[model samples]
Target: MTQETEAVAEEAFPQPGPQARTGRPPRRGRALAVLGLLGELLITLGLVLGLFVTYSLWWTDVLADRSAAAASDQLRDSWAAGGPAALPSGSPSGPAAQGDPNAPNAPGAPVPGGGPTSGAGGTGTALAAGTGVGFLHVPAMGRNYQVLIRMGTDADTLAEGVAGVYEQPYRAAMPWDASGNFALAAHRDGHGAKFHDLDALHKGDPIVVETRDKWYVYRVDSTLPETTKFDTGIVAPVPKGSGYTEPGRYITLTTCTPVYTSRYRMAVWGSLVRVDDMDAKRTPPAELRRG
Candidate 1:
């Protein structure tokens, strides 16, 4: 009776397996396992993406701003350290050749042959490519917003905390130069993004180019809010569609548009309004004075 009863009970309820004894669920199917793994991977990837965005948007701005400030300080220190040597007689925008009243004059004044002269006096002419030429101050961007102006407008150059001049196809015209477009380019976002507010510039805003010897005052006249990156005419000598029929001293500013993307270009054009000698105290021109 006992053996028969035990056999019946065992048959009705089997012994527990290893997994059941350990209180663990049965192993999942390969498909379920893969899905679980994918879920974990996706979670990890989301965290990585969040970190990347922080680095790109916030951390990069901090680093780029610091780098730009350092570069600007270096340029100003160099200028304060006695600047470049004197220019030779008859050099463009240099002092008039001895006793020659027809000698090239400073910017804003037409030279003997007509048109403004390149005001790169002494050290100005020696500014090599990728070198900082001066400081660009746009009050419309910010009262304290000033970026260094380098000679070549290249990726590496612009990332160094200042704007670069277009050196290929057409070299940028300097502000002191006569009857040409003094063009400049900077990043609209990231890597200092000096011109991020390029769209804020309005007609009549002042763009002051500060050199070691003079301040070239330009008054904003036109702005191309959005244009294809391939539209290079924004930096042209005449800057087609800039409302300028006659060649005169001009300044062009270019930047990427749409913020955080380089798919388009934005431009602001200004004509030379006047020039002021840079005094020992570095007095800004009247054009820079805002009411």
Candidate 2:
């Protein structure tokens, strides 16, 4: 070949160096894999910590004393306006809430499990049951939020900071007061929000539901993580001896678990253990005043 022709060929097709010819391919692939793994790990970490950061910003850190005081004041005012004057100077007995068990009955009562089932349909049963929710309070975890009581998965209560009460009118069946399961829903983020830390509850944790002049104490019996689509069977009245049941009025609490993900829900259940007439006595720890 002519010298000129040889030079032109060399320029057109440059040879690869030692590293590029053999070692570079595998090393490059490994570097890319490491980067991919790091990216995934970072994404997961952000998801978990993002909720924590949000809660830190939104939660009020005044300790349980402040919460207790606030709750006391709210109860006093509510009672005075509703009837029976104030909650005494000290503490009172019975349910901090009061209802005649037979006060002519409202349109719909709270449903077992959570959210408004399809049973209510377009009949406004959802809205009616939604009203029965009244107020929600968790003393141990220090949370109190005004419940909105909406229906179905369409509405995300966490975004709204509202609670939901499921009621009848759907094809599905639940019991009435002292009969079937009464279910309610809220959120959990370690914030001063509704239902946060619900899953962290152990057996014997305190949960209180209030009406006007009655206070019913419900101790935590069990907590279940939502793996399936919340079986209607699980929400059955009395929990059906499934290890989460007890006598008297029972309450089933439900919420989304693992923070920001709806992939699963966490449920904490309690049965009405003690009933008190708040118009009677005054004491701390709630149990001090009996019926």
Candidate 3:
């Protein structure tokens, strides 16, 4: 009713004290600080997790592949100089050639004395295949998967789509460079990240493979979608029609289709365009051998 009374009322209601701001005691600043801290912690954790995954895959692949290649190279050299007997029988140089880090230990094939000569007409045919790098890279998908020159499930350890190189009927199959179907299989989703993008690949896309000796570039020619049970008999030793013939060094890339589902498979077929030898200075070192 009086000027003094009105002034007192205004002070009493003046922007509720920090204590009664929310109808509860103050702690607004404390609560805000806690929330901010939690958010920062979460962000830091995410970054660490992402780095761990990337580095783990990268380094493991680098070591496993390097070891396998070194061993294979030794075996090949021994065979070239003399024969399997010349290979190591006990130590690192010994029978170790047969075993794989990701595969069960087994006897490896004795080296072939007389191998395919360079340019043997077979896409991949080559005597004493130069063993340098063993991996494939798909730039489009940021993929880098190990390649198995040996046979069996060795390659499947990191990726199950394809068996070890040794497991494949190598001698029976034409040289990768030879004029015939040169098929490679990799997991749809697994380690090595092989053919994971097999289904997503479009016509004319590039498929690049690097062996210690050279880099093979292939261009996708077709994309075939078949049911999970659709025989896939084409991968058999004697491939049926499957739109491929026994000539011209065709590169067949196969992976489970539908991205993350095994209900079916997508086969992306390609033909070898050019084989570039890294050491020959035809292509840059980075492009030839992925880091």
Candidate 4:
């Protein structure tokens, strides 16, 4: 009876297949597994976001600082090798000398050929795109604050901590030029934050541009703390709303504002106060000297 009964029971159940014994995993176990997989995915996502933050905030600053320093050194060396003659001591007379009240020569001094002449030339020709044109010094920003001025204002051009001058619609007027707007742009944050402290500039602050042959001195006249990115009028020849009634020599510095964002732009305006020939020592004008 026992053997016959056992054989009948085994046939009915067949000891159950391995899958049936495992029974498609317990519902609780499946739920736990799913949660484990999701946790792993979240961990990986956190790592990626952390890396991105490090790259944007830290590595970018380091790379941009290095690039800017190299460009600044190269420009200084070029100026040292071949620069303009020292300003002659005396008064310069004539219409050419009228604009620059701070020229080395006195207001009524005898002038030769006109006013001061740049050894580089008086035409103030535009440099090739992306090439360095000069060095910009803003004493109000910092004592060591200076950046190479380049030809284009594109992102790549400004990423190297260089300011680019606008050349379209109206060409940038060199300091030697009789009159026109010299518009420049740089990044306000990241890329070394070249113009990060632009807000620090106050009226009467000096914005000095050093060319191969001369130093153009501009005094801050006004500032537009915030403006839309598309507002090209800020760089206009007459610079609408800039407090200028007539055409004249002007300098405009533009940068993104609000910090770490490109939503708007800030501008600092100045008018050319004087042009000084590069001295033998290539010394900066007294206006640019820090106390």
Q: How should the candidates be ordered by TM-score, best one leading?
A: 1, 4, 2, 3
Q: Select the stronger candidate by TM-score from 2 and 3.
A: 2
lDDT of 4 by residue, 139-172 (tens): 9999867888888787788887788877764566
117-175 per-residue lDDT for model 1 (tens digits): 34312012424676767889999998767888888887778877688877766666566
Q: What 10-residue stretch in candidate 1 is worst by lDDT? A: 117-126
Which segments of model 2 are wrong by more than 4 Å?
Answer: 1-79, 83-132, 143-159, 168-176, 189-193, 240-248, 280-291
**Native RMSD of candidate 4 (Å):** 6.7
Give the C-alpha miss distance for residue 166 in model 2, angstroms: 1.7
Per-model C-alpha RMSD: 5.7, 10.0, 12.4, 6.7
lDDT, residue 129, candidate 4: 76
Task: Please give the RMSD of candidate 2 to the true structure.
Answer: 10.0
Q: Tell me the tens digit of each residue's lDDT in model 2 across 1-291.
A: 999999999899978787767766777888999999999999999998987676553643223224534544665566556654211211112121233222212123232344323331111122332222334556555433234333332243333444455443222111123223456665554323466666666788777655554555678877786645455444555453338434334667777766755567667777666655555443323542222
The C-alpha lDDT values of all candidates are: 0.73, 0.49, 0.49, 0.74
TM-score for candidate 3, please give it: 0.47
Evaluated against the true structure, the overall lDDT of model 4 is: 0.74
Off by over 4 Å in 4: 1-36, 83-124
Q: Return the number of clashes found in candidate 1.
A: 1
Candidate 3 backbone overlaps, count: 30
Best model number under TM-score: 1
